[model samples]
Target: MRTVGHLLSRPVAIGTALVLVMLIAGFVGWRLTGGGEYVAPTPSAAPTVRADTVAGRDSLEELVAGVRDGAKPEGKGAAAVATRNADAIGIEGLSARYVAESGNVDEDGSWTADVDMSWRAPGDPTLSEELKVGFDGDGEITGFSADEGTRMPLWLSGPVEVRRTGSTLVVVQASAEQADRYAELAASAVKQVRTVIGWDRPRLVLEVPASGLDSALGAQPSTYSSVAAVTATVDGSSTAGSPLHVWVNQDVIGDLDSPGAQVVITHEAVHAATAAPTNPHRPMWLVEGYADYVALRDTTLPLSKTAGQILAQVREDGPPKHLPGKAEFNTRSEHFGAEYEAAWLACVVLAEAGGQEALVDLYEQTGRGVPLERALRASFGFGVDELTARWRTHLSDSAR
Candidate 1:
């Protein structure tokens, strides 16, 4: 194979090098596998998340109310904040689960939830571990929390492969010792995606690529970029199969050079996993929006730079005529750096304004399932025209 050295630039190379650095981090993952199913007292009985008591009640209740009512909390610790919120709300046994799993903290200093959830409370504390939680912009605990003694066992481990097999998607690749670890990672990723949006896990195809990109693709590459250490594509409205494809650069195996690369792979893996049954027609904004949400949400990238660019662009030319021309966006997308940032924020705003579940709803509507414009209206309770207006206002506020 001929070397494409001419295609590389210093900054781009540096960025790629950063990704290479991230590879050293290896695959950090955890999952909840078979537990024989949670038996019910009765067939129709369902256990509820209880929050019945409060001793420090008055203060904690006020805090949770404030969070639910849109008040940003004083700190960044979601678990701590949630404990406070629950206390304020008078919920009993509302302790944050702290499974003892070290998480990979992102550049902005936030940790991703990559732990075995089965280690959480009320089960086998003898085998449990420490845990963590996640919060939104206003400090509301939007995701699960980890407790200190949640005992869980090893699931699977391996190289951790994810690709398509016929109409089915598959994820398999790890050592014999890590088969369960790899399976757990792929399964958890798929399940995490399906929690909000509905989709089935694709069959796992475990093998290292040794030939061309086509073989790497199990199918064809879409219109997006496909390069060394990365393969991205934007599939149009077609539901023949899954619309996204992802793979690690075999050369950089077991490296974590860039903290950001972990985020990128997980983000693309989400796209690959979220294969809805409808036509794959999502707008550039929604397409990139969902991916961006997965990429940078909960974690941090320099969002302020993107916010500044949005401010400058809006001030100079107003809030983009509708969706703005793709050509215009492509020509200067990086100039804003926040095209991805902005889109992710837009989704976040919509999700918050509606519900955490709104992210999944919007994904479905804008994904290969629902029409883009209709999905926008359904998810945000506003049409594309109105959303552009709101997005512009958000840009203005974020600038300040």
Candidate 2:
């Protein structure tokens, strides 16, 4: 039986569909040959010839004349020339291109050329090698380049499309024109969200209207509220089914603050990124509270200013040590906003007092695997009584 390499790279026949195999064989062969075994000739230990200073006076004059005639200075090397003039030119966003070239002039009348190219995709996590070339002739670099077709092996093939404006992703849908204000706000929001918890760049997709979203979710008209961004259910909670569906109102695309498209996009994205992954037993007080926390946190007001008032109110009335669970949050509909604020402030205080690491440890402990009471005890060292008293006092004292 013939080896795969032998069949592919051995120049067997015309009209063969084994080109890829042949290329692989060729690569293996090239690797085995050490690239033709290139070797440099040894230099002589003793100097055999000396320059005759007087005899070459005419030749030197001719050479100087050639230099005057636009011939570049030679033999000084391209590296020296590039060092002197490297700062003269600049390329902005040069990384977008596969190949780039640059050069400089030296004091000794030499020109240098630098060529560089990359073969990796923009979003690839791994570092890809960049190829460089330097050339110098008559002190000026005539040409430079990385190897041609070096990008063939790159794993990614397109430009990075997602951009972070704030806590939102400014996704330009194919159907709509780019809204400058919306994009800016979205980017800003995304940055704010990332500051709280890191996330990869958001994906930009085609804009879809409320009806389009309804169709995607296969929702009936009678199921949900008239609100465009309201969630709709698909099936039973225990069985696997689409739990939530959000619709976007296309008519109000112009607004950025009230019913703003960017806010809607980010709001929905937050629901997808955080809410979908949460365990079923997770408390609504933490779930919705966290989402509201992120949104309010990204606002222009300082954290203390935005959340401080509600926290103070909750501490005074509800006594935050007796923190409510998810079921109770929906029951106290009128106070839901304040409760969420209180939860956020509580978490913020925990982070500030004990540091982020400790708070993170607490969150991990309480999330699902551990009992709520046990996790709280482990994290705070104070039971419901002492911890709530201290927290309420802290809030009251800070307000004063």
Candidate 3:
């Protein structure tokens, strides 16, 4: 998820008298999420040499096959270990089914298996992938690990709870009540996205981890150290069927009040709904700016409250020469709140100039491979440079 088109910032944010200022501060450290494609984790080669028996006692086939039910046996075994892992996840109504595809026995009475593990929550669809797990000399599970570029869902990582609401599914590594709260937020996000993006139904799936390494989703800890949530391929391996998912860093998202949380989720929901991550050729300003525009659409907050960062920058540094680019987001990962506000304001310019429908049209046309200059002229009677000049003027005016 780190290298993907990470989107949204400021999930856990609240401070100062100015809410947007504080929210922008919370958004200061975001590593944009979401992307068009991803590389699947390279599964280890299945050992051709196999033995039916481990130490000539326990049947390797039986032990491996038993994991299909994901049931913990009486004492210890690989199946039991897998079952324990499922239980430890703590997601209500969750079940794991495993298929022992291939495995081999080692000289020390140890065994390794490539299990096609599939897990499901109540309202969510099942996600399955092959992961290597091993058992030691005494029939005790020894280890399990996922290489880079593989998603580690909570069901495979740690304890969690699940909640279903409408078309949204929330999995929180917290209490069931927490899951319910997140589901409500997701519902709000879906509703907000539907307000403008009525063209397609939004499938919002969020996984909120209360405590885990940032790399739990196969990202580097520092890459997204302060990201609120990101939209990316669920299992790292991009497929036509499995598109993307939203991941919330609880450590970052937990700081927001109700309204702030709603904005954060809705912002991500916009990215999810638009599939913004998949089209890498599109301008970053349009993608993130559109999400921010939708997220702040219905809010009653004044410009001072929602766009304080960019407004301040406009006052002190005048206006930016050009729109925000990939470099702006990457280099200012720790303090890009102003860039987001600038992007949001750019979208605001489009909406004001051509109406919301025209704004959506420009975004869609550009996403469909139409050049931005063409889209802008066709939709807004202007080109990129003209739009940038207008945006600069808007920034200068908003600051006053």
Off by over 4 Å in 1: 1-195, 202-239, 242-244, 249-259, 276-278, 300-302, 305-321, 324-337, 366-370
Sort by lDDT, best first. 3, 1, 2
CA RMSD per model (angstroms): 30.5, 23.8, 26.6
Rank the candidate models, highest TM-score first.
3, 1, 2
Measured against the true structure, the TM-scores of the candidates, in listed sequence, are 0.41, 0.40, 0.70
Candidate 2 per-residue lDDT, tens place, 1-400, comes to 4665556566754336367668889889989887876579998785333322232233324333433343433343332222211111110112212233334433333332222322211221222334333323332232232333232111111111223332333222223234344455455545555666545744322223322233333344333223334332222133223333234444444334543454455555455444333356455555555555556544565546555656566456644556556654552255544565666656656656666555555655655567656766787665555545665765565555
Q: Which candidate ranks first by lDDT, i.e. highest?
A: 3
Q: Estimate the lDDT of model 1.
A: 0.44
Ten contiguous residues minimizing lDDT sum, candidate 1 = 151-160
Residue 231 accuracy (lDDT) in model 3: 81
Better of 1 and 3 by lDDT: 3
Tens-digit lDDT track of model 3 for 1-400: 5312222233333232256555666555332443435578899986564433343224334444454445556644434544554543333333223345244566666666555556554434566656655656565455555555455656555445667655777767787777888989999889888889873656788878666435557766466666778887665654434566788877777888888888889999988787777776579989999999999999998888788988887888889899989877773265467888899999999999999999999988987899999999999999999999999999988888
lDDT of 1 by residue, 1-400 (tens): 1223432444557666666556644322112333453466756764443221222233334544543454535654433444433333223322223233234433433333333322111111212223334433232333443332231111111122333323333333444343343334444445445554455544322222322233333334331123222323222223355334344443343344443444445454556655422334666556556655665555555655335666666667665555433443352244534465567667767766777677677776565557767776776677777777777777666655
* Candidate 2, lDDT over the whole model: 0.42
Point out the worst 10-residue segment of candidate 3 by lDDT: 2-11
